[model samples]
Target chain A: MAIATDARPQRTTTVPRRKRVRRTKGQKAFAVFNYAMFAIFALICAYPFYYLIINSVSANNLSALGDVRFWPIGFHLSNYGQVFQLQGLTLATAVSVARTVLGTAGTVLVSAFLGFMFTQERMWGRAFWYRFTVITMYFSAGLIPVFLIIKGLGLTNNFWVYVIPYLVQPFNIILVKTFVESMPRSLQEAAEIDGANILQVFFRVYLPNMTPILATVAIFSAVAQWNMFQDTLIYITDQSLYTLQYLLYMFINQANSLATAAQNAAGGSLSSIASAATSQTSTSIQMTVAVVVVLPIIFIYPLFQRFFVKGIMLGAVKG
Target chain B: MTTQAVLQEAASSNLVREQENTLKRGSRKRVGGKPNGKKSIGMFLCILPFLVLIFVFSYLPLYGWIFSLYDYQPALGLQGSAFVGFQWFEMLVSSPTQMAQILQVLANTLAMSFLGIATSILPLIFAVFLNEVKAPWFRNIVQTLTTLPNFISWVLVYMIAFSLFSSSGLVNSVLTDSGIITTPVKFLDSGDHVWITMLLWSLWKGLGWGAIIYLAAITGIDPALYESARIDGAGRFQLMRFITIPQLMPTYVVLLMLSVANLLNNGMDQYYVFQNAFNMQHIQVLDLYVYNVGLTGNNLSLATAIGMLKSLISVILLLTVNLIAKRARGTSII
Candidate 1:
């Protein structure tokens, strides 16, 4: 019988022995505490969305809403119906969808292409160009100047306002650069050996292998475009071009105004009070709109969850 | 320099030489003395669009900051406007009301940023505890749910606040129905405790997302250390204290330093959405104030001046932080 001599450290041998040992009383208590804490945290994280869904379907009566906690009371869909019927809803939704699809695709392609170019060692003035891009990460010429530039470009009210300004994101480019650097150089070397041009190598070899990171950046860009209201708040003055987020923001303002008006009329004429009470339903409609806005992200997030986590880790570790 | 520093420098220089050698070999294989000019031009063309974009969007903004030195009237344009060197900056310090507002905004910005930095360690602790969970499925579920809020926009978050914390919202309704309070609390409207409220909301939105890097770092920790610790009769808590915490320290410190460097860059979105007349005094941070003063008040020069000051200060902060990091860790981020 040959005695097997393992070259591994004592730690490796001890790992299995340690796992076989029974947990102590302290360990048991700690596990219980850990479970309880995580459960509470998870509940806190998830309850708001659950509550919104519950309350959106809850009865429209203020008193009925007051009783809603864990479940919908006197279930109703009228609030969503009212939200769907709101002015500019269709136009805003169309703009939002278009921006998310186009903006994400455009940003992903541009950033990845630039990223691949930056990784080529023999490229002229590569260091200077790299520094030029990276330094923008820290310094910016403030909001007003950027706004002026956009105005000068006549993109203030243009739909491309959503697409053009965001075409080259420095942070995403850096992420893609690091990712491309991490890929086996032999893959590109082999392609070059086979007489593939730079674009062909990028599209055929690099991009196919970059699906995870590309998807991650695409999701990030999509979520950003969908949620962006500031561009509309600053650049776009036309109501027809308003994104969904801006529309929701306006609705929130309208709801607040209606609520204040109702409170002011509480001690006044009966007819005025009645009309104010009717407008108070705007609060419920606001909740319904919130649900609508958040639903897409909530549904799509799970699909890309693994890729995002990996992408973030890759970026952080290298960054 | 210490021996360790000298050794690291030599090692890095050796690595650079090796990389250069490989590049030379690659270039020799491609062409003779010079690089393949055609390929180099092709690469340049590939990156030209990005270069142009960076110039148009980013560098152009710095040039546009020249408007600060002039009274930039939109109708008159920068060319026709009168050049007023440091006029807005002078006015920022000279005018009593404007100076007071600047001071107030500065206070709000620093206060919120400091609170954020103070609580930055919460994510580290959160990740550590989260990693202690044994059930993979449960851990995944908790993480998925917690990270969901990070994807949601500030606008939607404010809407959630309205639905849950407004006067007739769920929380107040519950509190009143249970006879816990005679009056509904104005959580969203009241300016009192605004900093703490904002901090809480920030924590709610970012805790899980922020913990992700730490969690990843935790995964990278060698299990052999834990095994050895266990064999050494170290309990779970002791193992965590002695091994896990120490391993995560460098990552936490670097992130903390970065946060300190970015102390002035609290973006305006969250505050902008949450702002009301009641809370505006406490909520209007530097960036939001820039927008309000510039666009709403139509004081373009003043806003540009303020924005330029902010950028200069931020760059200074970044350099100073980089220096500190270099001194403390023998490495610098930038």
Candidate 2:
């Protein structure tokens, strides 16, 4: 239904030519200025990542970094090697990957299932249950209580803390419910006519047809799980349970403290201070860790970009 | 009638037929509802686990808010602890130091959130301009690259900031080596213009992602309006100014009002990572302050009391915004 309205807008292509014909020299200059501004804005948006990648593989010394402007200076892979060799990097990466996959999959399944259930006409107490979950979207018990509850449940220092608390995200449930409601009712009725049970109709009929919205919500859940660090900070005290983001956070803090220490020791002998700073984690290693954390999302983003845009559009239009 | 109007009429009629069919089917189901007891049980069973999870995770925490009334201790537990009868609430208002801290935290939260709302229009402008980009591949690349940062963790963003803004980092080193300044400028922890700095960081992370919704809104606008405006001698800028901006106004206003309602909900991730000894005084927003007071300081009752107040204010804000939206637009998000 939304696509029909959206498609109506693109049918009137005669406007472009008419608008172009009316453009004067000053208007043309304005167009050029618009392009220039966007170009600069795009550069500003993209340069940090570019700088990160360049510095990550660049030689890990102050002298090598001094003249570096747009690209690597004396490029080497030593920083990445150092990043990989950092204690707990592999374990943290594993934990991150596992949580993202499991948490996203579990959340998508449960949210979609509940969403499907809520849209049923004959479901018992549908209004009450729907409102019960949806109201949590506006008001929550606040942080301390939620933390105490999670602690009370003994999820602290547990991996399930990442997955279980987020398994039934009410916002995603609403998104899925909206998507399912927009689907033609005949799809479900036809499956019912074919002797499919509710579960079969849901799994075989609705789930397949829900790929676009499901993919969108999956990307959302995946991003949330991957980027989460606050839960680890609040719930997990053990170093072994730290996700990659938290590990990188710790590394950044460690590096900052090292720098601060070096600054404070600046009044000491130059030779001792220089050696102490050199022994600390280099700027290149920190950037390399950042590149490591960010690269997966960059690699996977394009694959899901189309559905992602559609999902956002669907949400905005519905709202 | 115009073709578009005819199509819309046909769509609405079809929807009416669908609704009628569903109503008839619903009546049939109501007549046979008692006989479908087994099936209803199965369906209820399917949703039972989710209901349990919600009750446990979401509703249970609301009950846990009673911890604020008691001097909560882990060993004694809420049951064992003495009920102080609004002592924490009393302390929040009566204690001068606590009142000062609350005021500061509230200021930081409102400042950051208002700054965020003020800059929200940038995304609309960005979407308008980005829609005008003629090259598909270039626009796509820029959009993809820009939105990619929104998915990145704040921890990584802080790392990026460290690389650029640290004392021995690239920006400072380059400036010093070129004789721009003798002493390195502390960008990260200087606590100067922290509001603007955080706002800029937020814009960098979210501007493109935020623009996606406006761009979507733009796509929904009927092109025939543009066609008519252009044939009447509207230039590109004129078309955008008169047609596009006005079309996008409702969405902009709704979003702006919603952000105002969410003034206290600045998540602690970015500020948490960026915060240190030097900048904590300035950067600790309400959410982070709650976390610090509760977990870091081990003052659970005080944290819970402050958190309860924040939540109450947020609920009020949400209801007020929803009421305004309903009065103005005849729709509430709820």
Every model: iRMSD: 8.6, 6.5
For A98-189, candidate 1 gives per-residue lDDT tens digits of 99999999999998988888778668776678778866766789999999999989999999999998998876776787677768888888
A271: Cα error in model 1, Å: 19
Per-candidate DockQ values are: 0.36, 0.40
Candidate 1 local lDDT, B262-288, one digit each (tens):
777888888999999999999989999
lDDT of 1 at B108: 97
lDDT of 2 by residue, B1-334 (tens): 1111111222222333334545766666543234364436677778999999999988899887888899988889878988998999999889999889988998999999888877878888988887777666667777887787787888988987887788877788889988999999999878788888888888888888777777777877878788777668776778889988889887777677667777898878889999988888789999999999999999898899889988899899989987987798876644
**Highest DockQ scorer:** 2
Each model's TM-score?
Answer: 0.88, 0.89
Looking only at chain B, model 2 earns a TM-score of 0.89
lDDT of 1 at A229: 84
